[model samples]
Target: MLRPEIARSWWRSEMSGLSPEAPNLRVEPDAVDRRSRLAAAAEPVLAELAEQLGDDGFCVLFTDRESRIVDMPIGAGQLRDRLEGLGVVAGGVFLEETTGTNSIATAHELRRGVAVHGEEHYLEPFKRFSCYGHPIIHPVTRRLVGVLDITCDTGNDSPLLAPLIARAARDIEERLLQSTRRAEQRMLAAFQAAAAGRSRPVLVLGEGVVLANPSAVELLDPVDHIRLRELAVGIVHRGIGSPPPHTVRSVELASGREVSVRFQAVAPGAEGVLFEFDKPDGTGATARIVGSARRPGVRTTEPVPGMPVYVGGEPGTGRTRTVQSLVDGGRTRIVTLEASEVAVHGETAWLADLESTADDQPALLVVEDVQLLPDTCAVRLRRLIERPGLWIALTGAPLAELTGQGAALAAACPAHIDLPTLRERTEELPELVRAMLDSLGAGDRLRFTPAALAALAGHPWPGNLSELNAVVRAVAGHRSVGDITPWDLPEGYRISPRRRSMTPLERAEHDAIAAALRECGGNKLHAAKRLGISRTTLYNRMRTLQITT
Candidate 1:
């Protein structure tokens, strides 16, 4: 009998225009470079299990949530010519629509273990294979990380496969929990050493972690924390052996207190970097290693009293934080506008609210993602820019992109501040990492070891600070008790093929179009409709991409 979950997934696939016409499997070679948390957590468990299973012509596969195989399978005979020929290999998408009512896709969708045997598959070609799948969910977050599968040829299918797969998934989950517990213990131990004295603030550093003392936490704002962590993570990324060009940093907190700090890999009984702070009373200090890029747009000598300030940068490069830093909290109230968000009431109606700000009030109009604003919103913003009494601070992509949209936007704000990408001034990463750790809720407890820096620095940081922050948070969650090492880092980061090389959206579009054509018998018109695009657009795309079909 077909399970309800299986039946529904099959029905949904058919409804979505999936065909059993053997769509050339969407194989993402890029995934090969990605580090799979599931694979790592499942490894030791599977290795021991594989030994016990004893080469029973069965294979175990691990995949990301999307069902793209992530690792080499365990068990099974060495020869995999039959599986490879059927596109049942690493990087291939074995979703129900592509390969039919299979265990991997069904389990991924349902977030449970499922068994699909032989003739139950919707695709005829897949009927020769039997697969049982279990969803691997993160133990702490209870998030569905990926799917694990046990597959065999029809004659090798056994009733015991489901239970075995379930056991493996459980073991992975337990391992995840154990690692988290270990991280907490290690973090607390390091944090205590760093926070011994309340006289100065110190960032508790560990392998792949940057944590803050309560004093340090109070001293820096959220944005400062971000910058600090970026620097720390940068050090980790650059490798422990690579020291910063210089160590001392003299920074004025938003509170107007100027403090001198020393950044160096302090020699200790244990491993961790420490940022020891001191009063800048001419007693102890060194020239801070400043970033190379000048803040041409930001007025550092004096605050911009009333004039409009324009800030621009790529996503996750800290444009918002930069703009927020410029705000004079004592004088003006910060009113943020997400210009990119199209409200249900429409942009025109949304713009009308900006007019509500009277000239009498001292309000700073802050706009985020200005590059994504509609032309109508741009016109409205232009009108606001002309208001003499109105003070505005806006963030965008680049000056060129802003000007390309229209001159009104380009002319309104003449001074543009472009934030530096991570690749440009990587030397500042250690400091940034310090700030980032301080900003995170759990960061006060965690620290990064010297060796851990290499693991964090592996990627080119195409996503900039945004990606770095996420990776730091994830690594903190994944690591067990210890001074972090390269092994503690995500495998994806370690063997990264360079994610900055391609966008996921572009990859998804290319895969979808190619799959649509295969499913629709290479008919342009049919494929276009299936892809929800017009035939002319489809033809143009095909020609542009040099797709023969």
Candidate 2:
């Protein structure tokens, strides 16, 4: 009898118009490359499993979640040909949608071990072999990454195939989880180092939070975690120009005193915040902490009035600041039009004033979020584009994205510059941060450690300069005055796992297990025999080497 789940999956396949009579052997090359990491990691484990079934007439198959055959090693040549003839070789797709309900895809669909024999197979071509498959689950995430299968002629079916495939999948999961444990350990160590010597509460952001020395972790409610993450993401990357006053403003703890927190970059999306509550040393004179201030990266010349200017960038990317710098030394009548406003109201507000202006007058018209400029506004704006003594600056999405409909608007304002994200300007970060701090009056008071700078540079800045600016402002406002170490930054940034050194015996065992598994075609039984140890002993050692299945 077909299992209820298999029956449903078969129905799903039928609904999708898959015919059981026709199974194609076409392989997707892209799928193989996409699963390179999984294949590389599972190579030894697969070889070991294949060795154990060496003469047992079972062929091992590995496939990605898409059911594209990634790797396979067969026992009997004739059986291999039979199965390969039915689209069972590497690159063959076996999902219900592709090949109808079969063990490899069905077990993946069920996300568990399953043994399908003869008539249980939805596709007639697959009924030639009995197959057992188990989904290779991600240990940390508990998501199915791929499937492991053992296939044999119907007469060679054994109850042990399910357990064997399941164990192999578990083995793969264990290896995957090892990486997670290593990452978590590094995060914990970094948090510990950064949190040391600080009296303030230090919260490290990641997939979850890790608190440092003085912080009472219990005080942080689950809701606070969500709120803090949202605040951090919004402030830097989410196009939020500024954090709400309630979020960045000092919060009054239950102790009847206000505590100010500084959010520093952990990675990019993550942040570590240091809290300062009623510190006797609290003496910040500036109401707005300094973000990065440019020391004129561009040498300014006198603006030739009537020269068309187009400034373009995402929100908070120094485009407006650059424009202001260009107009600093002159009396250019500046009029700003927010394209978003125009787009919303369906009209440009400054068009009347712009129309009345004398042609020879020196003027700067800045359009913010110019990508939002409507078709009608683009038409009106074009009329003013060729006016004498007028300069137009624009900022918005990339020109390529604007080409479809906003091409005319772009053509109207010819000068274009694309601002690079913060990740692209790591070299400038240190100087920018320091200069901004000096301007904020904290240059003499604080310095960032090499580790801190390294952490900052490594971040993939999704929010660009604005996020970095917020980070600098935060550090100045709340960080303890001194060299900013990696710990002083976010926990995520400080993560560096200590390299583990294996003992001589462990080294020997690792080498031996690896060699034995290879020589035995990954058959643990023969490998155990070759190593002169019991199969269980071999299993234990493979686990030690992280190669067991």
Candidate 3:
């Protein structure tokens, strides 16, 4: 066996001439500890090593810092018995100078692997055992952490064992690093969710909450939100914990409240804490309604005053409220038309849809289910949009077949808006509920249970905002208490049954349109810009695709 002093000299040689100021010369104690823990937990790796070396009369063992054997491969029973007979025990530490064996001693001394075959062991009892071993390092920080050893009967010693053992150790380290990275990513995603209005409010304490995103400020009190330092201090003080290092506490909020606070240690000297809070119930109603208001022919911006704005969305997506918000109860001569039934009027009667000249006052012409219009009516209606004083807004479900109709309207006015699905705008649901409750005069008294919010969030709102609103209204009307629980939701609203007719292609197109509209905030003109087409062309495609606005 190599001398312990010689191995130490070799390790010193590896670190020779390293300047303390060098960026790469940093040391991490926690990384070393984590690697050690990983090595202790590596059951699969140990099993693999056993399979590869057992037939050759070899057994694999993992050791902790003090050299105590913490783990052994399952198939190494006989070898383990032999080692125990040779004075190796679970709590007994093995090292070079003490045991006079190359495997453990050389590994510790050199901070790497070593092999001692047959007679190389100074101790006669170990002479029959040939061993190969290597030090395992932390994959991320590259710090030596633990040792892996493979031992076999003296007759089984071979040249290949040393390198094989080293490679196995490296693989374990890599896995450890990968696991660490994935965990960090998950934590970061959770933090971001809180920062955005999408998740419970969260306050990050380390490094002043790192308010890198716009929504991070929303977590703080209105006055405190702008000051990063103040926000951090508040989180540190009000956070559920006793103090910086030993604090651990949890508090349950009123129903509908969502918040998560965490204190995580990134590294030995780098730690961060996070505090998150979800909005009170009903705060997201307007945003949800707006999200669902995107329809192919809807106009986001009012190009002219007193123009009827049309909105199309799935059955429940907010269509009416959004339009009302735009009108702001103005006396702009509003005319509403629903496509539930179509009346065959004269060609000249189509002119009635336009702003009348009785007082020359501009009119807002809101048309719903433009898809239901007969071809002739659609064409004539398209002609009326050409009149300079008329403002027309149209909304409908997937109407790709109405591309020609859309093209005609596009020729008159190119602007259009497409709303997002309820699923896409789930982040805004809580706020929407709050807004709706307040509008219904339940602002101070209304609240939702955690289960209710979770159900709402998980549901794929087929009808969009309209459905959400109806459910909320129903719950509020039926419930006697302030809290609305998931049980209070309309029957089957949370469950989506299997439907066989929906083809994959149709789903893909719907998803694509929904995604595009979300990215463009339901602006048809912007969505058209992204699709590399004119507003008119987009309308035609929407018609062809049977996509409602």
Best by lDDT: 1
lDDT (Cα atoms) of all candidates against the true structure: 0.64, 0.61, 0.55
Question: What TM-score goes with each of the models?
Answer: 0.45, 0.41, 0.39
Ranking 2 against 3 by TM-score, winner: 2
Per-residue CA lDDT of candidate 3, range 94-193, in tens? 5442354458756766687788776666556767788888887766645565788888888777888888888888887877677656545544664675
Tell me the lDDT of model 1 at 433.
61
Candidate with top TM-score is 1
Expressed as tens digits, the lDDT of each residue in 230-334 for candidate 1 is: 344433222334543326777654333567766644332223456767734434433343332233222222336577767776788888777666665545477
Off by over 4 Å in 3: 1-262, 265-302, 306-312, 343-362, 398-402, 491-549
Candidate 2, position 47, lDDT: 77
User: Judged by lDDT relative to the true structure, which candidate is superior, 1 or 2?
Assistant: 1
Q: Rank the candidates by lDDT, best first.
A: 1, 2, 3
Error of 2 at 517 (Å): 43
> Where's the lowest-lDDT run of ten residues in candidate 2?
285-294
List, residue by residue over 96-192, the lDDT tens digit for candidate 2. Answer: 6567677787886678888888887777878778888888876754657789888888998889878888888888777766655654665566567
